[model samples]
Target chain A: MIVSIEKCHHCGACVGSCPKNAIFLNDLVLVFSDECNRCGRCVKLCPVGAITMEAKK
Target chain B: MRKIEKDIVVVGAGPAGSMTAKHAAKKGARVLMIEKRQEIGSPVRCAEGISKHWVEEVGITVNNKWVAREVRGAKIKSPSGHTFLVDEKNAGNEVGWVVDRVLFDKALAADAARAGTEIMVKTSATSLIWENGKIAGVRAQTYGEPIEIRAKCVVGADGYESQVGRWAGIDTSLKADDIDTCYQYRLTGIDYDPDYCEFTLGSAAPGGYVWIFPKDEDTANVGIGVQLSKVKHPADPKMYLDKFIAKRPGLKKGQPLEAVAGAVSICAPLDSVSMDNLVLVGDAARMIDPITGGGISIGCIAGMCAGKVLAKGVKANDLSMNTLQEYETMWRDRLENKQWRNWMAKEKLTTLSDETLDKIVHTFSQYGVEKLSVQDLLAVIKRHHPELVKEFEELI
Candidate 1:
């Protein structure tokens, strides 16, 4: 998932809903690593709608 | 190894999945829906804003219990703070409502259940079952144990990252450039009319826009979206939102009640949504509207379409790639052209600088172009900014 620091609101919704714990409010934005399962729970739980699914073409 | 049988298996319990189950049940078909989440709509996404007309078109019953607020118009704010009120005359009759999405989604699922569709929560479909080159059923894990469910047909109503569709051998990947990153908040104790939704355009959000949808006189859902490809400075949306909120006299003092963030696809592909014994709906098929980032309406529509087509296939005792192709045609005929055009428009609009946007907003305001449809607005731009007009003309 693409976590844009500028677009994050630190809602914590994404952090709570990520099945694989791929998101966290490190500074302000939820940061994810290559370990993400791409389950999309974080993307769906976010009220502000900031995180997007990113996969290699 | 446990085996169960059903007429149809629907993966996911979002709007598309529920609607697919509902319509199939209405046709007297036995439908089973599996949702990975324990509760429907608990982890809320989306602004919960939808046009009233789409509900009416789908023959859904509207009630206050699920509606957060009703709106009759929209206001557009340029990056420089110039505002344009899209009067009711141009906003269309069904400007719509900001909904309690959790409630609305639950109600839709409830409606499907009441119509005889069986729902199983906390279950995930792990893979698709194929026999002799045709889909036969799905291998699912429910409550942490492996279980097999056989079905005549399977409907993939799963969202953007649809594993079921992927397992079914349908290509569902979205290009990084085709997606949007968005953020939203439910603010209470805000002072604003509950009758209008507000949109802020231009530099506030690159390649996207910001919206304030009122849930009540003191509460609203406000957020912003920007294209994934255009993040130059790459400022987090929250920082920009804070600045915007700090500047907005109406919202600066409002207390934020709840904050949520998520993503939605703008250019979801539908060409490969169907294959043998399986069809994809909603974000799995990438059926979202490219311009507005709205998918609930389109997802529901796709669900209903998939349901109808799947039912016909089952009744005819044929759920092959050929039969399911009917759904592909139907949805494409209905939405593909428009969505493709909207995607083009989105691309063109995203390329504009904030200054150009301000000029467009100013010119539109001066011409009272809020009264015109988006197509008409393009014509106005065509007249004055002919060079820019070419971009939009091609989109149309």
Candidate 2:
């Protein structure tokens, strides 16, 4: 998942919904690690839609 | 890396973290609380409304420094504008106060400091340290400097996205059905009444409700929460809230001072909040009320319960799940029924159509609520719409 920093609220909502526990809020920055399975749950749970799929390679 | 040692290390300096640290420290346990933020209560992520009764119960002395408005009651409005007024005088619940969240959080942290908790700001827990096949301490960073914290017990008071609990192998994850994504704006020049907090139900907020919590006569925190499963588009909560504000003549001219976004979990009480040397408190433990989307009071109460057991475990030199089970028992005895029952009620409320919402509110408006509970609501509907009680009876 890719987080649009400008739109991100840093609210940590995505961090909780990530089934793999791949996301963590680093102060204002939202980090998505390799552990993320691209479940797309965080994209939907994000209040401002800050997170989105990184477009399948 | 510098090494710090303590009996307990609480991650996240929110109300829950402060309460746990305070209670445990007062009991003679050396406690340390770490916060990622430079300030204790910066980046407000809550509705800032807390019921008054739990404050005294948990031994929090109210100070005018944090209170913004003391409300007598709440105004629950249906989609069609039908109103059910419930105040402290009649309702089984106590009245509440709208607070300046930043100040309230700081005051709580200050109180914990007074009780002898060592607080470190701009210090973040990066991961948990495991030693000898058991829970040990935390790996943290102080500013840019890496530091290691060695503790006998770890307390996860982190909020909705509690990483500590997950790292401890606890399932604190929320599915779309259990979480509500929220968006809020601190608006000025509104028609909101300061004496009563307002909540509008129905399609305006899909699975959740739109709330107007006043800061004063001219300003208020206007927000909306929607079930994640019900969100069909990007920024659905903000969309719904803006639509509601546009339709309201009273709020049409309101101007926003700040925008805040958050999420609330309205799930059933977790299967466990403690194990071995680790304990979870507050939102990290899914203590939020399902029907109200409120967690401040509930979190504080659980923090106290967890604190007592946390200290005892340290003193006894037993941080095993066996010793920490006292915390689980205390919280379950006090809060299990309410959280479980409200989760059921929320499920029923979410499936309700706007028309049914109008009916429920209209019926409730006639008598007003004596107590806020699923059973009480079903009883009232049983007296009026006998058929309505059937759908809800299955919940009980």
Candidate 3:
């Protein structure tokens, strides 16, 4: 559930999408943290197609 | 490498996450908040406009450090240059405020930290840790090291760029028509009224509006929003804004201090925002007003609800799908129902022709219908256009 800064517009859409309330826009970057539960709601709901899911390294 | 455990863990550190943490911590829950950025608020993305009364409603403290200017009312201008003033009396007493968004967001995070929530910046969550087919916590990376977080309840506050909720399977997708592309600039040397929020609606931004929210007497946050489906000719927002400014006698000489581009979801609330042990708040849940494109007010309200419900679920040791249902029900009761009505109206409005819009606005003004309800407006439209009644009937 890592965020892609380039795609993000800071609309605050994903901030409310998290059940755990895990999304926040910090300056120019949207940050996701340890509270995320892989709900994938934010990934599917981004208005400008800013969010995506990548496999763990 | 780090391993930590807590009663409630909130992700993203944005308004929703911070608010949730604040409330949950106020209730005596051990709260942990994480962010991928070094600072809480930076690189401003919003139009920086917010309703004035939001402070009292969301129980937020008023801080002069973030507020750029206090607005008295909203003045809406039609396509043909016709204007209508929604004065403070007709509108709300204090309509809104133009803010320094970065400062505002940092204040929120600071509030949460002051409430006893541990905030970790420059941290990222990679995936959810599952246990018995339900989310147990998150696997995250701080700096370059791996860390595992285990908590009874987890929250996603990650913003429009959220993947945490999607990973949990809530179907947070938006249609092209349901979303808006926005562009904004922090302009200085602009001589505009600092007490009024101005909106120019119609051809300038089909299916959306252009706004000038004052930051001060000499500066303002100027922006425009357009529905993705109505975007033709690939026009840039800043270009349109500059052209508009050039035409205005007062703003032709202003200097742009910064540029911002973003998008907003004017869609209705989602069918669900809760999973077994996870909850989606703010933009992830799609709890935004379709007409105004405002979410901070609703997001904070929803966060309060999520925080309270989640705390109860954790206390009962019942952070399961059934238990988390309370979060969704509470949110709907508080805001989703109203947001859905607005979305329906937005759908009807988007399909309207320019002439029809002009006629409607003219008729409303002529009828002296200064105080209008969304439901009443939709009813009026349906009565006159029966053939299109089906489109707007749901609004009633």
Candidate 4:
């Protein structure tokens, strides 16, 4: 999952929605950690539609 | 990184952070408040409704600058459209002012600045600075520049998903049921009663409610809060709100002026809000009202409590957990029991079926029970419908 900083409002909805607690907001930046398994919980939870999932390369 | 020092550092410039900074600075402590947003309250996420009494309790006067409208009461509409009105005097903190949140928040930050607190906008606390296993300061970035600030005490007023609390090893995680995903629109050209705020309950908003808080005779904030856990399928809150508005002719004709979206934590207060030299205030401590999802007043009060305790700790040269724990005890004494009761009430509300909700509203209206208390509601049920009273017996 990738969080576009420009679209993100820093509301922290995605942080609380991540089941693995992998998504965190440090200062104003939303960081997706290695613990994320591409679960799309945050993608749906984001209010501004800032989070998106990408296939692993 | 530019190094700065202060007696107290408060993260976030919302009501809680600004109030904490204001009180602490007034006590002869050097306070600095940091906000990540360029403007203090640019994006308004709330319904903008607050009780008048609490505003006064925080020593903030009610004025035309921020108050959009003064409401006389609140009307609760059940799923069946049966309504009951509760007067403002009896409603207590349930209803009062439909405010301009942008102005209100900016005013609060200005008040803090006037009280000798230095405020930095567009600054975000990236992480906490720990010394000997206690929080000593914060590492943050101002705009694009890095800055390190050290303080005797750190107050985390950083809203719902507080990273400061997370960094300090506080479990800020909430269950899906305890969080409300909300969407709101400031609408005009609506014929709504400006004197009262209206709340609609039941399946229309599963596990939560919808509200119409009027800013004027023709302008209002139309919003809905749906419990994330209660949403059985993948859905957007906006879709539900749109469907709801489409059903009402008056609202369907309304034009959207502004749109706001956010999530609110609607759970009981955290187990502990203070550890070592750090203390959490407002939404960081989960002090929001579980039933109404209102936090402004409670947050301000908690911030004042935190500011007082932190100032005393600095004066005593002790920023230990023991000293900061005073804030925990003080806020608990003032707000804990009420918050816990509200959470319990919210639990009971979520389990209610739509038919049951209609029956409850019908009962309240029939009995002319304008002022609602947990005990009164239970008594009304017991007198009119004995079977239903058993289900709510625990609440009383």
DockQ of each: 0.15, 0.76, 0.11, 0.37
- Ranking, DockQ, top scorer first: 2, 4, 1, 3
Over B1-396, each residue of candidate 4 has an lDDT whose tens digit, in order, gives 699999999999989999999888888889999998889987787898988767777767667999899998888899989997888556766668889989999999898999899999999998899878767899999988899999988889988767788888888788888888888889899877889998999988888899999999899999998888775544367777888899999999999998877888899888998888888898888889999999999999999988888888888889787788889898999999989888988888899999988988888778866455767767887888887767667777
Error of 4 at B85 (Å): 0.8
Q: Estimate each model's TM-score.
A: 0.86, 0.98, 0.84, 0.94
**Best lDDT among the predictions, by candidate number:** 2
User: Which digits, one per residue and each the tens of the lDDT, describe model 3 over residues B1-396?
Assistant: 578998888888878888888888877788899887777776667887787665776679888998878888777777776555666655663477777778888899888888889988888887898888878898888876899989888898877767778788778877768877777777789888877888887777778888888888888878888776665533344456666778877777788898776678899788888888899888767767899898888888889888887778767888887777888887888787779888888887887776766666655554433344687655665556556557676667
Stronger candidate by lDDT (3 vs 4): 4
Candidate 2 lDDT over B1-396, as tens digits, reads: 799999999999999999999999999999999998899998899888878878988879999999999888889999999998988866545568999989999999998999999999999888999999898999999987999999999999988888899889988877788999999999998886888889999999999999999898988899999999999987888889999999987787899989999888999999998888999999999999999999999899999998888888889989898899999999999999899988988988999999998999999999766687678778888889887778788764
Q: Lowest-scoring 10 consecutive residues by lDDT in candidate 1 chain B?
A: B230-239
Evaluate candidate 1 and give its CAPRI docking class based on DockQ.
incorrect
> lDDT (CA) for every model shown?
0.77, 0.89, 0.76, 0.85
Write down the worst ten-residue block by lDDT for model 3 chain B: B363-372
What TM-score between 0 and 1 does chain B of candidate 3 receive?
0.93
Candidate 2: deviation at residue B349, Å?
Answer: 0.7
Q: For candidate 4, what is the TM-score?
A: 0.94
